[model samples]
Target: MYHYDNYDQTLVDERVAQFKGQTERFLAGELTEEQFRPLRLMNGLYIQRHAPMLRVAIPYGLLSSRQLRMLAQIARRYDQGYGHFTTRQNIQYNWPKLEEVPEILEQLATVEMHAIQTSGNCIRNTTSDHLAGVAQDELEDPRPYCEIIRQWSTLHPEFAFLPRKFKIAVSGAQKDRAATQVHDIGLQLVKGDDGETGFEVLVGGGLGRTPIIGVMIRPFLEKRHLLSYLEAILRVYNRYGRRDNKYKARIKILVKELGQDQFAERVEAEWAMIRDQLLLDQAEINRVQAFFQPHPYAELPAEDAILAAHKQCDAAFAAWFRHNSVAHKVPGYRVAFVSLKPLGIAPGDMTDRQMDAVADLAERYSFGEIRVTHTQNLVLADVRQSDLYELWQALTALDLATPNIGTASDIISCPGLDFCSLANATSIPIANGIQQIFDSLDYLYDLGDLRINISGCMNGCGHHTVGHIGILGVDKKGEEWYQITLGGSSANQASLGERLGPAIAKEDVIHAMEAIFQTYREQRLDDEAFLETVRRVGIEPFQERVYGDH
Candidate 1:
């Protein structure tokens, strides 16, 4: 984790004081709701359905055990004993009082954390792969670049109030775990065939009312030009990106309007003019990289008889190992994922106790490094194979192990009408309904690896478009309806899902999903994946089963 220097500390402290005064004025009636709205938004506070939600920025999703403990403390003290981790790798406390929020920020400053740029469209937190520093197949540790972007984007004067929010994600992994393709500016660190490191820069990718996978602007951007090129992209967006309609304001629409070739040309022209004039350079990146140097991890024995025994003795442990464990760069250690989508519980919602348990596990089993993924899961990057059972025991006590890591029941859902005012329907309830239907482990695995992602609105908070079976909440004459899309995924073969038919009512949404899955179960050829079946046999067959019954 990058520690804040005196300069960073001063900025945060000053902002806290400024926000405290703003809060006081709002409470004293000196500032109207309208006056305080933007101020609160800039500080990452949202007036939700029932109360104020405070979004706490977890920069690049890298946090130490100490930071995780601070979050747990904050949740217990200021929130409703829990925090909701978001799709963007930030955390939101749904029930924070307006007056107490400034105090919360003040406390956070002590831990080098703040909510600045977590909301209100001003270059939100730059997220990265959860296993950035530790992934075995990584080209490089992405945290340094993510941190560099964080420093550049935070409180940027020119982009303070853009037409719409901007988001960026970076990943160095062979797998696009950061979902870089779906961001406003997506960066993938790649090693060239000639053994040189560069970036695969994607422009105009985003999710919201409209979803578009980013188009590659530069296939191989030199490491030295990273920051300058980013500045060029921002300059281009600021120059010509739409401000008339919020829906059309994202860079994706800009690229769509002016074809990618023209957009790339414009960016190239912009880069040619001012690449050297940007605030950052190779020296700055080198300085930042020094701050994010990997920590020393203790070496462990390669052979682990104990781990083998646990795997052989416990069927539950075997299932968990198959799903949650991934190879680590180090020989004897592996990365383990703490799945947040345990059955019947709200996805990404964690109690204070559970948070503490995770902190303990991160500190004990793995190195003290903890990471938050865009999928709302936690990663223990350096867990030794020998300690898997002990770590599993601790996690089990916290109800963290359900052995349904990536199955039908392990659904990706958003906090819908329950918290978000923009939501047309309750997303949590829909997720729960889906979980209830696929409660049986055998049924879920037999149904095969399916992703059922739901969103309350078209904002794509749940990343519904990339789901194997995507569901979007719709507003139809004061009633809530859900539209389904099929065959989408965020992987090597990325593609947007196609809609099946007319939207179904809220009551029928879950049933419609059941019909689709049942239809696939009957129609799939020879254990073909859900996505393969959806592609081979189009949405028509599933539509017939769903709409036919309705």
Candidate 2:
């Protein structure tokens, strides 16, 4: 994790103080709601359906155990006793008092954390692969680049107020776990033909009301010009992106209207003007890269005898190990996912106690660090294979050991009408209903690598556009209806899902989903994943099964 320098600390401290004053003024009637809207939003505070929700940025989804404990304390003392981990890999306090939000910001600053750029029409948090340095397939760790962007974008005067919120994601791994293709700016680290590292840049990809996979703006961007090129793109968007309509303001919309070639040409022209001025030297790249050097991993056997024995003895532990643990770059180590999608709880809601316990577990087992995934789970990225059993036990005690990492039960969902005022229907209940129906582990494993993402509305906060099976909530007259999409993915070959058919009534959503699953099971070839089957046969079969007799 990148620790803050004095400059970083000072900047955050000053911002906290400034926001404290702004919040006080709002409460004292010095600023009306209209006046305070942008200010509060800039600080990641939102007036939700029932109370004020404060989203705290977990930059690139990285957290130290100390920071995690502080977040637990904030959740315990300020809001309700839990916080919701979001698709952006941030945490949200849904019940925080408006008056105490400034205090929360102050507390977050003490741990090198802040809420700045987390909301409003500005460059949001720069996210990356949660398994960054530890992934076996990675060409290089992307976090250094992510951190560089974070520092550059944070309150940059030039981009302080864009037409709409801009999101950037970087993926250095062969697999695109960071969902880079669906971001405003997606940078995939690639080795150039000359054997030098560079980027494959994608632009105009986003999910909201209009979903589109990003077009490859640049097949290869030199490392030295990363910042300058990003600045150029932002400049182009800021100057030409729609300001008249919020819905049409995203960079994706601009790219769409102008066409990919024209958009790229505009960015290239802008880059030619400023690229030389912002060119990064090797030293600057090295300076940022120094923070992400490999962890001091011990030399251990490829297989843990005790762990193997424990797996043989405990069926539950074996299930968790099979599903929740991923291979690490180093031998004898694993990246363990702490599943937040239990049977009844909201998908990513972690109680304060669970947070504190996970912090403790991270300190004891994974070098005191935690990584939040875009799928709304936590990652202990350096757990030794020898210690897997004990860690699994501890996580089980905290109800965090759900053996359904990529299964249908491991749903990705947004805080829909239950919390978000922009939502038309409730997403949490739909997610819960799906989880309950797919409760059997054997059935889930049979379904194989199926993803179910839900969003209350078209804001696409749940990333429903990328799920293997996407459930979108809609308002029909006075009734709640759900729309389904199939074959959407944010992985290596990113693509937006296609709508299955007419919206099903909310009461029939579970049945429709069941039919979809059944269709997959019956239609799939040997060991083919749900996504593979969807692409092979198309959504017509599943759609017919779901809506055939309706």
Candidate 3:
């Protein structure tokens, strides 16, 4: 993880103090609600349904044991006893008091964390592969590039107030676990024909009221020009992106209106002007890269005898190992995912006690490091194989040892009507209902690799656009209705899901999903995953089963 230098520390401290003053003024009536809107938003505070929601950034999803403990303390003291991990690799406190938010930000700053750029129409947190450095298939770690962008975009004067919020994701892995294609700008690190590392840049992709897969605007952008090219793109977006309507203000809308070829040309023109001014040097890249060097891994055999024996002896440990653990680049090491999606709990919600326990586990087993996944889960990226059984035992005590990683039960959901004022329907109850309906773990494993993502509204905060089984809540008359989509994904070949006929009533959602599952079981080929079957069979059969007519 990248530790803050003096400059970083100073900037964060100053921002916290400034926000504290702003918050006090707003409360004291020096600034009206209208006047305080942007100021509060810039600091990641939002006036939600019942109380304020404060989003705290976990830059590139990296956290130290001390930082995790700080977050736990904040959750315990300022808001409810739990916090929600979001799809953007951040955490949200849904019940924080408006007056105490400044204190929360101050506490966060002590741990090299902040809420800046987490909300409003500015560059948001830059996210990358959660398993960055240790992934077996990644060409190189993308966190360095993400950190570079974080430094440049944080409180940048020119981009401080863009037309809409801009999101950027970078992935150096062969598999796109970061959902890069759905971001405003997606950068895939790749080597060119000349063997120089560069980025394959994609532009204009986003999910909200509209969903679009990004177009590859630049096949290869040199490493030295990464910052310049990004600046050029932002410049073009800031100039041409619509401000007349909030819905139309995003860069995706600009790219759509201008056409891909024209947008690319405009960005190139802007780049030519500022490329020299903003070109990053080798020294700067090296400086950032130094922070992400490999941890001191012990030399071990390819297989651990003790771990193998435990797996053979303990059925419960074996189940968790099979699902939660992933192969690491290093021998005898594993990257283990801790599932926050239990049967009745909110998909991403973790209690203060659980957070403290996870911090302890990270310190004991994973070199005091933790990474938050885009799927609203946590990861111990460098867990030794020998420590698997003990780690699993501790996680079980905390209710974090759910053996459903990619299965249907491992759902991704957003805080819909329960917390978010923007939501048309409640997402947590729907998610919980679905999980109850499909409670059989054996059945889930039999069905295989299904991603069910539910969003309370069209903001796609839950990433419903890319789930294998995508559900979006809608308002029909005075009641809540649910819409379903099939065959979406955010992996190596990302695609938007196809809608599955008309919306079903809120009560009928579980039944409809069950019908879809029944259809899949009947129609699937040998050992076909849910996504594979959807693509092969198309959406018609599932639609017919769920709706029973047209």
TM-score for each prediction? 0.96, 0.99, 0.99
Instruction: After superposing candidate 3 on the true structure, give the runs of residues whose Cα lies further than 4 Å from its correct spot.
Output: none
Per-residue error (Å), model 2, residue 73: 0.3
Task: Identify the superior model by TM-score, candidate 1 or candidate 3.
Answer: 3
Ranked by lDDT, the better of candidates 2 and 3 is: 2
User: For each candidate, what is the lDDT?
Assistant: 0.87, 0.94, 0.93
Q: Write the per-residue lDDT of candidate 2 for residues 439-522, one digit (tens) a residue.
A: 578888888899999999999899898999998999989789999999999998887898999999998999898899899989
Question: What are the candidates' C-alpha RMSDs?
Answer: 1.6, 0.8, 1.0
Clashes in model 3: which pairs?
A: none
Count of residue pairs whose backbone atoms collide, per candidate: 1, 0, 0
lDDT, candidate 3, residue 96? 93
lDDT of 1: 0.87
Candidate 1: stretches off by over 4 Å: 279-283, 301-303
Q: lDDT tens string, model 1, 306-374?
A: 888989999888888887778888777888888888777789999998888898888888768788877
- The ten-residue window of minimal lDDT in model 3 covers 541-550
